[model samples]
Target chain A: MSSSSPLLAELIDALRCLPGVGAKSAQRMAFHLLERERERGLKLAGVLEQAMQRIGNCSRCRNFSEEPVCALCASSSRDRHVLCVVESPTDLAAVEQATGYRGQYFVLLGRLSPLDGLGPRELGLHLLTERLAEGEVEELILATSPTVEGEATSHYLVQLARAGGVKATRLAHGVPLGGELEYVDRGTLAHAFGSRQSVE
Target chain B: MSSSSPLLAELIDALRCLPGVGAKSAQRMAFHLLERERERGLKLAGVLEQAMQRIGNCSRCRNFSEEPVCALCASSSRDRHVLCVVESPTDLAAVEQATGYRGQYFVLLGRLSPLDGLGPRELGLHLLTERLAEGEVEELILATSPTVEGEATSHYLVQLARAGGVKATRLAHGVPLGGELEYVDRGTLAHAFGSRQSVE
Candidate 1:
């Protein structure tokens, strides 16, 4: 708070709004920006602003994208007939980093939690059902987190996918208990991808 | 890294340039920024750019400022005859936070490291000597780090201030060895200020 520059203090406060950054960490980061070249700091600021402005949910897959369709959705190399569903953009990134899945992704903005007022409609389950009914999606992979909410979400999606006549499964084998794919090691992720068993 | 969005990867790389921010931490920060409103991200970016463009060294005391003299140097409440010298603006903030010293500051920009080619002139020791000769400053407080380079710089400054007929002292009595003022608690920092002993 005793920092001489008001702008620097404001910038630090804005950065501290981040999930893990505290006041001290934000101060350190502000000092780092001060120490570096003006161009470097400006570039970082520009990237932050630009990303927030341009990126949104892909119209088809609901994954984050700068355009109407995400790169994965647009890529012909990807298997359109197989869709891997995830809870958030972060989870989608983790799966992509594993580099084992050749299929496209469908990002559910949230999981089904009726207690918290998050119902199937809030998770866009109707849209998913419509997508499944198109008959192009042969297999549906449930790649949500291993939390209680995630389990319920996967079960609901699987039932819906099966009723729509598409094969549906959950990721198993290498994924540990209470695991978040984002924090898992790459080898473990690859192994999990390779050894995934049928949920039914 | 073959990420879905190259811009996201770029932002993460930029975030990693911050002190103590590793790749994973940077990714987390980048994602957090991306999740926020575009206006929030732009506000941070704008502050960063504006701070860099507007803030510069105070002409009198060398601390960060938008005007000719920094707030401390320009204020009538501050002891114009006492100057607290530090390695950077952040260090100056730490001293100010202790609230034991109402004095102006001279930022060295960096410490002396002969191996790194940072000699006396590089740290603006000549300007410090000139300031002392101008005659209002009665005390020169060496508030630099406890590192070898800081000690070497302090020794050099002490000799210069003595020749200029001003009292030169290092805040050694309360400062711990191998510790940075930025990380020191405010209580210890105030104790260090209160118990400062003179250096030869």
Candidate 2:
């Protein structure tokens, strides 16, 4: 039956905004949460509230963390001298899942879209310049996707790194056109990282 | 990345149990709830918890309701003498969405499944006899789907209603073979209701 409570309907509508969820699926999820074990559902709500309240971007690499620095940046085993630039924390996660990367990551948080008014300055290019000026980062790996916007982001980063006197390179080609990094297999990611080429 | 936080992961797992939700969709929803507005997410949780805690089977019809008697059952406009019987609350809602019937409903809560050890006794068939004995219901409509199990449930209910001395009928022949009532459009449902045939 149609929900008598408008609050319940609003909540379900909010949930429907999540990727790939439609009205019927959202209704089922809402009903399951409301009509089954509610404590478990509330616990999830608590987690969401806590994460939104506490999670922040790492000052150094921009991966989400509870502290000033992310776990990867804080780890001494990772090579700080070879920084890998990526588009988002989600992409950084896919790379980490591959388990072959032992380098630091610099997440852009978004790709350049000039038509959408997104440019280097808006994407924290100045902060990246400051990080490069710290003189520890020597080799910079561009691991953004092969998409038009991703390519533009990588090229801009390469110019920024070169101007700052750091060696800049893009990950080796093999990433299919229009393919997201999340869809690439771990082995392909490892191969791409191993065969990275200089971006002249 | 797969959610590292146990609480968030549990919630996501629970959400994924809803029909049509996959792992990727669950992950995306989990992230949205965690990263976006916490209040909205928590409100959804609260709705779920409240619904499960407060809503339960309607005393008169056995359909899920926030009150002792469901809105449909208590409504002055609805035909109290006619009751549409269904297998579950989801099925009840499906019929209501069709908007062809202005009568109330009686949800069986489950169908008879002898193979799964679910018989009429297990599905509260005894309680149905009590309602039929009240003698207010003039016509009983079998709105249950045409599935093997659904047919079995309908057959059993028809026998019970006949012995109770009530006029009983099954929703008409227009419904597609092996098709569920939830998938049928309102027009067909209206037509089916208008052409309902008496059941032996």
Candidate 3:
């Protein structure tokens, strides 16, 4: 759309850099900032600049952090013997919130997708190998998603763990808790049926 | 969500200032920027800051502009005898792009919503009245929306045009072009039935 103000056009264009924002949404955001939220918009700009410049990956876990090592990795209270591996920082956060896993974490940042140029090196598997070779970790928990790429990454990590003499485990895939079996998708239902445990 | 990086947390919080962005969307946007679009994210910050600081209302038309007078208001090619009053700059752009109307414009920035503190003064009707009283404009077109607030604002503008001895006209309202009448809303269908136009 043709904008009367060049700056307004520029603002709308810049807003499209955000995920899920398209032309119409970008225009709405730009107009919203101009009409109602100028102060907060300025604050956002300041914070965005700082985040882009200062936020870096954790040297140990590969999670986003301002420091060399993330808070979760640096914390002495968390267990160091069981390491949970996740696809991204968001997945790491999901695990932290949903489960009572008190083990340390290793963020892959991405799955092992050769088509997208992501492999063991891109996932910082060397750092994970060094950590496992330290002999402090007794088990490596693979918490990647159930998608094909996630499964492939988990399989690769399991091999790495086996090479380091650490026990490898994975998150269970099945019909979710509180969900009706009839309402579950076919793949999930089939998986749950195949993995059913015998009652004692 | 607990973020390892304080800057990342702040960026997520700041991103919520954008229209339609909630916690989850903000987190996704922040991570997307940190993971892939760092350069574009920084550029967006710079442009956002410049837009927030530099953009202001046009002196004549009340549209957003970096200059004291917007390009549309300053142009000599547009017909000075005709003035189209719109609710916002976006509407002005819509009219500019969709039609061959080469008249001048007056942007109200908002409609008449007293509870929301948008009065005639806030809508810049006084400036419009002054422009009308200058005797340069022979016709004033009211292109506000068909909503109650928009109608009220248009009614007020009609009176202002009458007082200035200028002809007043409003946009035709009915079922939209290419829209099925069966699917049209009751109120709009009723209005269209009541105001059926004669064949030329």
For B94-160, candidate 1 gives per-residue lDDT tens digits of 8887668877788998999888888888788888888898898999999988777887888888988
Off-target runs (Cα >4 Å) in candidate 3 are A1-3, A178-187, B1-3, B113-118
Indicate whether candidate 2 or candidate 3 has the larger TM-score: 3
- The top-ranked prediction according to TM-score is 3
User: Better model by lDDT, 1 or 3?
Assistant: 3
Summarize candidate 1's per-residue lDDT along A1-200 as a digit string, tens digits: 34355666777887776667799888877777777666677777777777777877777777667778767778899888999999988788788887588888888878989988999887778888998999999999999887789989999998998899999988864867797889988877997888778897
Estimated TM-score for each candidate: 0.83, 0.78, 0.93
lDDT of 3 by residue, B156-183 (tens): 9988999999999999988999999899
For model 3, how does the per-residue alpha-carbon lDDT over A90-153 read when each residue is reduced to its tens digit? 8987898889888899999999999999989999999999999999999899999999999999
Task: State the TM-score for model 3.
Answer: 0.93
> Where does candidate 3 clash, by residue pair?
none
Give a tens-digit lDDT track for model 2, residues B4-56.
23444454676665556677666666666655655666665555556546666
Worst 10 residues of 3 chain B by lDDT: B1-10
What are the fnat scores of the candidates, in the order listed? 0.56, 0.28, 0.87
Evaluate residue B185 in candidate 3 and report its C-alpha lDDT on the 0 to 100 scale.
100
In Å, residue A54's CA in model 2 sits off its true spot by 3.2
